[model samples]
Target chain A: MICNFGAGPCILPQEVFKQASQAVLNFNDTGLSILEISHRAPEFEAVVDETIKLVKELLNVPEGYSVLLLQGGASTQFSMVPMNLLAEGQSAAYLDSGAWASKALKEAKLFGEVKVVASSKESNYTFIPKDYEIPADAAYFHYTSNNTIFGTELFETPKTSVPVVCDMSSDIFSREINVSDFGIIYAGAQKNMGPAGVTLVIIKDELLGKSGRKLPSMLDYKIHADNKSLYNTPPVFSIYVSMLNLQWLKSKGGVAAIEQENIAKAAALYEEIDRNPLFKSPCAVEDRSRMNICFVMENKELEKPFLKLAEERGMVGIKGHRSVGGFRASIYNALPITAIHSLIDVMQEFAETVK
Target chain B: MICNFGAGPCILPQEVFKQASQAVLNFNDTGLSILEISHRAPEFEAVVDETIKLVKELLNVPEGYSVLLLQGGASTQFSMVPMNLLAEGQSAAYLDSGAWASKALKEAKLFGEVKVVASSKESNYTFIPKDYEIPADAAYFHYTSNNTIFGTELFETPKTSVPVVCDMSSDIFSREINVSDFGIIYAGAQKNMGPAGVTLVIIKDELLGKSGRKLPSMLDYKIHADNKSLYNTPPVFSIYVSMLNLQWLKSKGGVAAIEQENIAKAAALYEEIDRNPLFKSPCAVEDRSRMNICFVMENKELEKPFLKLAEERGMVGIKGHRSVGGFRASIYNALPITAIHSLIDVMQEFAETVK
Candidate 1:
């Protein structure tokens, strides 16, 4: 069996793919592809409604939170979150953990005063900074829950007086969390949810209409909140597939059940890296991400051959990012435990042969 | 046969839909669904490469024009185009024709001095203004190629010394034209290309870098152009399906052949509306859009029965925009001539019964 470790736009639930394929040919017996349906039509509306409802139910989001399936990736929300909430002089605090988190901090700065309360850059982003105090007067405390490229995660959120905001792009739905702790939680659908094209932004309704900044129609959360995601045409096919994936998550006993499986898969891979002499993980032990695993060899010459052997065994997409070159294996929400074991087996055999 | 007239996220060719369905299940036999592939990987890189190539071949876009498949829809570009190209002191010419056109004008005003060269607001935007002078010193002449809500089109582009920028959101690839004439052409894919979430921007390479503005990474056209739409994680599935639609357009004899069919379909429906006293075309004779035909009854009371009968007969999404309070039949590229005939026959029968 081939194991896919592609970082984002990685693996999806098999059943979601099956249902998505069926819907493409005929949706709701309408004799039309889901791609061909109008968002304003009732058929497409049902897809949007159910997807939002499932997201709220699965996350156990509070009564006042409004979920929006928007276009662009989480990068767009980096600008939009501030544009809709932060006024000219008001400040927001952001934690810089990795590339994506830093990019969000920079984009948010364009709209208002963005204070970087904590940063992990000094350690090459191998560790998450702790004990940084979030300002009480800041509008929100922005953080990235997981960093895909660097293989790091913020295990525990900072104690902040302001409302918490998170970009849970890489590790959403992989663990249990109290949804009410966040004022906003945004995620790009490409990582763990469904396909690319949609960004899920869940926001507390009371937190909105306070910025007093006149935002463009597309950036205005109230417009999307009032329209129920139908103010304009939405990504119909992507949202439909996301709903299917959520149903698969539900069938598998929701977040609590998946969290246990994720822990097992991550532990198996990390254990091999720790015990094996040839490989060494790059991230700090406490901050290592459950989703992405980054590792390197004591002797750099073995990296290429190790990757070649893994490919021969039908293990793919393990090359690390150019920015931080080595090897990476992303075991996202849909990555089976069998795949992780197969990868570990390959790694052990490759290390033995090289030695 | 069901006649789909829903405005956007609308109809696509059956062949395109079929191919898209196959790719979603098994993309190029990678043993993974298309939704599960990484944008940075070679498999999806090829998809993006071939898509840009096909767009150039179909449009006859000039040598220097770079095609970018971006997210956030045409609404985002309404602000980004000006943000990237228009400097604070330099002015841009805008033609206000409809709701979207006016919105574009408003966004441009936020970036630079906006010159309203022409407007059809006097007639409630039922006609396109003529003989307006485009400023020679303006950065670009911006206009909406086809107004979806108002059902007006610029049959012939205006001559301007400055670069011509167009928002072809509703009518791109529905007809043929010289792509070289415009400095930039942008379209939200929901209308004629693919689904929502992906926006196509074809920009002249030299026209950029003149604004000297510190654009955020997401809004900078130069960044995406340099990286070949990989400046960030793109909307992958939406872009892949767009490639299928473009391929379908090529197989069915490209834009020139489809333009002939489009003209015929528009003529057939408009002829019926003009000849019958019970119904009347709302747009001016010289400004009618070939893609979207807006019509109303001589007596407004007949609108309800017409919509009801049409919906019952599987002729869906025919009610006009709420702003206009009439009826609109959007005969886009994927709309077959048979559907137009069905609508025309219904119009004749309605006139006989209602009169």
Candidate 2:
């Protein structure tokens, strides 16, 4: 009955958990735990195949793109993006929207020059900076499509002629995007995907091998793409559970259907936060994230009592990121509308008690 | 009842699987699936702490060494090892005993100069190379402790003045080792540990950052060790299950007790492989891997029929690596001695029928 809603590595569908547990006992009745099975086994290859196909189908990825399920999370992708795309002496443009965004740009700086085209760091990243331009000479334009820490999301792909790379760790599957618009899209699997071990990378095939640097085999996207993400052992259980989760998503009618539900849950919760005298959202209205609904208490002294009552009512993992002291109702794809309603009830009860 | 002899992601204690399955349902009665809990959560952090402690306890890791559970497997370490230790204009010496050993050298070449002190490649890597002299002037001496594919293993650390780095992916934890003898010891978790997603790295703290290379954060061992593998979202499920597996190992009397069991199982299996006239080991006797017991048919024509019968008798993954092309009974730690007996029975039955 606990409405668990922590950030990345957050809630997955109950069915996925059940199926994953069953697989641990016996994967596809192979008489072996999914964990104990070899990655090269035909059964596992099929799982990888289906998982990749599901990602491509859900994202409507174009022919020229390769979708990879890799390890090391989005943090690894931070350096890998520039290692493959930004050639020596070339600079990459970045939109630093939050902590993760700043971290991404910082890693990019190690490989080559980085230009901060826009950043809301001065305002403590409460809003996504909009009034900035992607330098025409920059090698690529990078942005955080959704800043989980700041509760902000960039809805529109910036108007840039150059290729774009995005960190969509929090919002990849909650809504559909034009896959062809970006040269590279990487997200850690902990959020909308499945778990923390694997990451999803969608790369425009042509964008690889352009970097003048001699990259290590693991960091080379072309090597992974050419090998179909089987360049190494891969995070097998993570990918298998992700495959199950994606299948669940497909059964619930894929990304488009999930988007409608996500929007509804966010709209309801945001409305409640705005309506309740005790609560207020910390994000800009136009840029607020649909997945991670970050909010704060209007009265500072009420925060602890509100959290305690919510906990007593079985609301878990509502604590926000330390960077921003508040509550974050992460209504990711797996969170049902019922959890949102329960949260609203808690908020209303708290408001009445305070009055 | 099924005997899975796959080389890696091979086998683990049954209780670990059951517990892992239950955790997927609800981790520690937190009313949250382990897959859904945030990595930053106190419960997950405790899991990480205990896992690191378990590694140090099981391996008897000495002072000045760091034990880290990382993602990307040993293949990632193939590069990270060189990237962290091989300084510019310096050369690293490698002992090329098998395919994996050769691949490690190739990756080292990407970082700086790699000196292959000796290679058994001409013999199809059927034996561990022994007569090589590691250059004192080299950055460090590198070697693969166990060659999973070719069924060769280096049991004794080579006498080298330079820091010795070993990729013990296949044989770590199967036997006791002096941790102070090497600069680094790394192993992928799939074999003797838990599953495929996480890797174990034990580093002698002083050897890192000597490469003088500004490594990408993920590739740098110091960053991971300093952060205790929490620099980013770790492969949480893999690490968690590894902790459970390590606990199971400890309950079974830790590595010393398991070593005896492993030796007994390996001795019995090797005895059967040697006794059955139809089959003979392809690897050198002195260098034969106790973990992956590779043997080929004495009469090549009997190979297919023997494998078919073995499969019918529930002997799975006994097929040798394609390079060796006969059979490999990978008797990893969690594989009971009973499975070894079952394999011997299959071999005897096949031999009697052919006679």
Candidate 3:
């Protein structure tokens, strides 16, 4: 009956964890731990091959797109995307929605000119900025798909003639999206995937080799795509567990089915926040994150009892980010609908006591 | 009973795998899976803090040295080391030993001037080149500690007047050495540490901030060191298992005790190859890699059977690199002494059958 609501390095399905643990002992009856196998071996190659294939299938990537299971997290991609795409005198359009988007734009500025098309910083990231212009001649339009700390998201991406790059670290695989709309989509494998060692990058093959910059082989997607994700020592265990999580997604009828459940879970929690007079959600209603639901109590005195009551009832990791006070409930793909019900019940009890 | 001899991501102790599996299920009795916990939570932070402390103790790193668990493998460090240390006009000395060392050199060359102090490529990397002059004013002397494919190692590092930066990907913690001799040492976690998602970087604090170049945040060691390896989402599962492996090392009398056993194992396998007329060791005796022993069959026709027989006898993953074109027995830190004996026995049987 224990519920976990920690964000990124967040909750994974019990079954995925179980299978991953077993693989460390005996992988595919090869009698060797998955960690011990070389990437060049057929068995290990199969994992890489199948992982890419599954990722492509899940994302509905187009024919010219290549999926890479790379080392480093989304922070790495913030620099690599610019290193591979941007050139001198070419500007990239960046939407600063939160901390992550700000960091991405800062790194991009070091390489080339960056235009802040829009920003939510003025509102302390409590609302997503809607009005922005993307230049047609810009290298690309970059945006953060989901803001973990601010608990905000863009329900619909901006319409831009240029290529779009999104960092979907907090809410990848939780909803359905047309992969063809974006030129590149990258996510760190902590939330909704498995753990925090691998970053999944889906890039359009045609977009590469245009920057003319001498990029490091490790950061270049073209080199990795040419080598089939075997150019370097990959994050093996993280990629393996990610495959298991993807398999679990497929078994539950893919993102389409999971998206419906995610909608219901988020609705249940948001409903409680709206009904309780003592609690208020921070993010603008139109831009609220479905994955991470954040709220603060009107009376700060009641916050302590709310957290302690939830913990005593066996719910864990319900605390919010340090910069953003109050509580956060992270409902990733692996979090079940029943867990949301438990949190709703706890909230209702606290509401009566506060009054 | 299966013996894994793949270079790395290499074998780990069975006990470590088991205990780590338990952590994934219920970490510290928090009723939450380790994969589900937030990084800022006290429970998860404790794991990160303790793991860093354990690494410092095991290596006997000086007070000024900072240890960081980073994402990306050794290949990532190739660019990162120079990006943070080599200023625009500064020069660095590189030793060209094999494919990996050459790749490191190529990455650094893009950053600043580089001097090829020595090269073993002329001999097909069968011997380590000696009598090379290092630049007195160079920013650092860079070298790969062990060549996994070529089976050649620098038994003793050069006494450089400049600071030393080493890529110890294949043979870290396999033997004992003074930790303070080098300014910086990095190893991919797949070989001697844990799995393939994390890299351990140990650097002297004073040597940082020398490079005036604006390094990308993710590739900057000071960024992770300043945050205690929490700058972004780190490779959690890979590092947690690495902690268990390090704990296992400490319980078994640390690196010194393991080095003795590794030495004995390598001696036994090499003795068998040298005494048997049917086999020939590839590298010179003085520069042979204790971690990866490469040997060739005297009769070219026997190569197929030797590999097939070894596989059938449950001695798995002993195939050599395609570039080397011989059998390589990788006796890493976790590879048992019994596994090396089994390989020796296989070699004896093959020799008798050929006669």
- Models, CA RMSD each: 2.1, 1.0, 1.2
Worst 10 residues of 1 chain A by lDDT: A208-217
* lDDT agreement with native, every candidate: 0.88, 0.91, 0.87
Candidate 3: the clashing residue pairs are none
Residues B229-284 of candidate 1 have per-residue lDDT tens digits of 98878888888988989899899999899999999999999998898788898889
lDDT of 2 by residue, A1-355 (tens): 7897788788999999999999999999898999999889999999999999999999999899989889999999999999999988999999989999899999999988999988789899999998898899998999999998889999999989899999999999999899989999999999999988999999998897889678878888988988989998999999999999999999999999999999899999999999888899988899999988899998888999999999999998898888888899888999889999999999999899989
List, residue by residue over A254-296, the lDDT tens digit for candidate 3.
9888989999999989998998888899999999999999999
Tens digits of lDDT, candidate 2, B50-149: 9889889999998999998888889889999988988889999999899888888888888889999999999999998887788999889999999999
Q: By DockQ, is 2 or 3 better?
A: 2
Fnat of each prediction, in sequence: 0.73, 0.86, 0.76
Comparing to the true complex, what docking class would candidate 3 get?
medium
Model 3: per-residue Cα lDDT over B278-341, one tens digit each: 8899899998899999999878788999899888888876777888887988999898999988
Best by TM-score: 2
Error at B13, model 3, angstroms: 0.7
TM-score of each: 0.95, 0.99, 0.98
Deviation of model 2 at B354, angstroms = 1.1
Question: Model 3 chain B, poorest ten-residue lDDT window?
Answer: B30-39
